[model samples]
Target: MIIGVVLLLVFFLVNISIGSVYIPIPQLIHGLLGADLDKASWETILFLYRIPKAITAVLVGISLSVSGLQMQTFFRNPLAGPYVLGISSGAGLGVAIMIMGGSALGITFSSSSNYMTWGIWGIIISGSLGAILVLLLMSLTAWKIKDSMTLLIIGLMFGSASGAVVSVLSYFGNAEDLKLFTIWSMGSLGGISGTQLEILSIICFIGIIPVIALLKSYNAMLMGERYATSMGVNIKSLRWAMILSTGLLAGSATAFCGPIAFIGIAVPHLARMIFRTGDHRILFPASALIGSCFLLISDAISQIPGSAETLPINVITSLFGAPLVIWLILKRNLSSEF
Candidate 1:
């Protein structure tokens, strides 16, 4: 835990320091301390932009990673994740409807009074509703399907169906709206402002409460449903909590940052490898810390340090996560560990 915390802080500082304009360590410290900087622009870049972006990266890392852990535990499938289970896609679909459908309906989101406030909340609520809807559908199926692999297949089908809907919406949408949705799908960590950051933080906080409360249930469930049931765990309620927590975390992250891939699927495994334990108590915090560090590093890399150009956040995560998924498949070690 201590090591993870140290790495997280180190990566965070690096993420903030190495953006477009490299701020020297001394200047960065001065800006953080509220001291006058040699250049006013340095302060603006550090406080107004880089700091918030770094914080968003941290929150996203923790949210997706922890949510991934919950999903894997709940379904007992190594490949189960927010993205894999269609939660992220569902959220993306909702955002698409709001952006594309709103235009079709002649509803302008950005021109109205309190547009920023309404716009952010609108996306969040829409994303949450979409995620919850998919989760509920999967929950209902989970009752009849005893096999985890079948449920995994169903989740993938859900993702595909949602993606198809999004494509149809985009095809008939306005050019400007299509462009906006395209850029959003590309994923971004730097787009969030301080206000959006606060809202994201609160939603994540609400989602995490259930995760923390259900740690015991998660540990018991790992032993198998029969054992968990014998121990008096309420299987039904546990599933609901898992779905709710995963939806809030994954939905909020997608709503604000777009459909970020790989982090949700990869981070839990990274945590398991690092801690070499299946205990949720250890894995939970470990995943959060390691996930944050992984994302901070990805954010720094996406900046293409010393260059003006930046790559999409999803691109970097996919490059890192896809190979990990393949390795897990080839090794055939999905349910063996947890």
Candidate 2:
């Protein structure tokens, strides 16, 4: 626990300090303490850009890691993740509809008007709702059918169908809306603000509460659903809770941070390697911390200078995450035994 906290603080500080302007340590400390300095451009850069980006990275990390862990256990698959199962895609479809489709419908939302962007919230909710719908269908199939792989295929098919719908919506959308969607699809840590950050924190906390509360149950579930059921785990209720939790974490992260990738699929493996244990009590927190650290590092790398400009976060993440994923697959460590 102590190491986790220390690593988190160090990574967060690194994220806040290594941006383009490179504010000195003293000014960064002063700005954080609410001190009244000359308000230099570097200080502004630290406060306005890096701080929010750091916060977004940490929150997104925790959200994705927890969601991934839950999905892995729920589906009884080692390779399960938010994106692998199409939860992120589902959420993306939701946001694409709201931002791109809303403009197509002639809805005008501004930064100042809270009511106008309820449609954005609607998109997020619908995305989560769409995931829940798939989960329900999977639950039904699980009872009548026996193949977990079949359920996974259904999830992928549902996600692909949703993506197709989004493509159709984009076809009819105006050029400006298409551009907005494209930028959003590229993903970033710059989109969240203090107020939105608070809301995101609350949503994630609520989402993971059940996981924390059911840590012991999760341990049992990790052993296998049959064992968990034998140990008095309420399989039905637990499935529902996990689906909702996965939705909240993945949906909220996608809503705010624009569909980050790789952390979910990779962080749990890091946690397992660190602790050498499959126990949820340790795995949960360790995965969250490692996920945050990994994303903070990725976000820092995205701020590389001497280029034409900072790369899109998605591009930087793919560079790191995709190779790791490929390696994991080639090594065959993604099997259920792990």
Candidate 3:
């Protein structure tokens, strides 16, 4: 835990420091501490942009990582994640409908009301609804299906269906709207700001709190349902909690930052691998910290430190995460803690 915290702070500072216009670490600290900066623009850039982006990256990491850990435990499948299981895709579809297909539905923002005001909430609400809907569908199948792999495939199918809908919507969408949706789908950490950041932070904590409160129950869950039932754990309520947490965490992040991939699935495994434990008590915090670091690293890389160009945050995550997934597949004895 101590190491994770230290790493998180280090990565966060690094993330903030390594942007398009570089700032020395000492000056960065001085600026943060209310000292005059060498350059006035550096202060503006640090306070207004980089800090918020770093904070957003951290929230995205914690939300997705913690949510990913919950999904892995709930399904008992190594591969289960928000993106792989269709939760993100569902949220993406909802956002797509709101952003791209809104005109078709006769929804329009008046000149007096800019998009940021009403649009942000619309995206969050729609994304939440979509995530909830898919989780409910998965829950129905979860009880009946004993095979983990089969359940994962079902989740993929759900994601595919949602993706198909998004594609159809995209095809008929106005060029400007389609471009907006496309960029959103690619994912972003720098997009969130002021009010949106607050909402995301709140939603993530709401999702995380339940898991923290139920750590013991999650540990029991890993021993098998029959074992958990014998121990008087309420299986029904546990599932619902997981659903609620995952929905809020995954949905809100997707809604605000776009559909980020891999962090959800990859971070939990990284936590397990590094910590060498299956205990939710340890894994939960560990995943959150490692996930934050991973995201900060991704965000820094996306900035293309030496260049003005920045890649979509999603591209970096997938590029790094895909190989980890492939490695996990090849090494069948994953999660030694399990």
Question: In model 3, which runs have C-alpha deviations exceeding 4 angstroms?
Answer: 105-126, 132-158, 324-332, 335-338
* lDDT (0 to 1) per candidate: 0.83, 0.75, 0.83
Off by over 4 Å in 1: 106-125, 132-157, 324-338
Question: How does each model score on TM-score?
Answer: 0.87, 0.84, 0.87
Q: Write the per-residue lDDT of candidate 1 for residues 133-195, one digit (tens) a residue.
A: 887787888778766567678888999999999999999898877876787787898867777
TM-score of 1: 0.87
Tell me the tens digit of each residue's lDDT in model 2 across 165-213: 8899889877766776676677778756667778888988998899898
Residue 334's lDDT within candidate 3 is 68
lDDT of 3 by residue, 162-242 (tens): 999999988888776777678877888885678878888998889888999999999998887778879998877787687
Could you tell me which 10 consecutive residues in candidate 3 have the lowest summed lDDT? Answer: 107-116
Task: Give candidates' CA RMSD values in order.
Answer: 3.3, 3.8, 3.3
Please list all clashing residue pairs in model 1, or write none if there are none: none
**True-structure lDDT of candidate 1:** 0.83
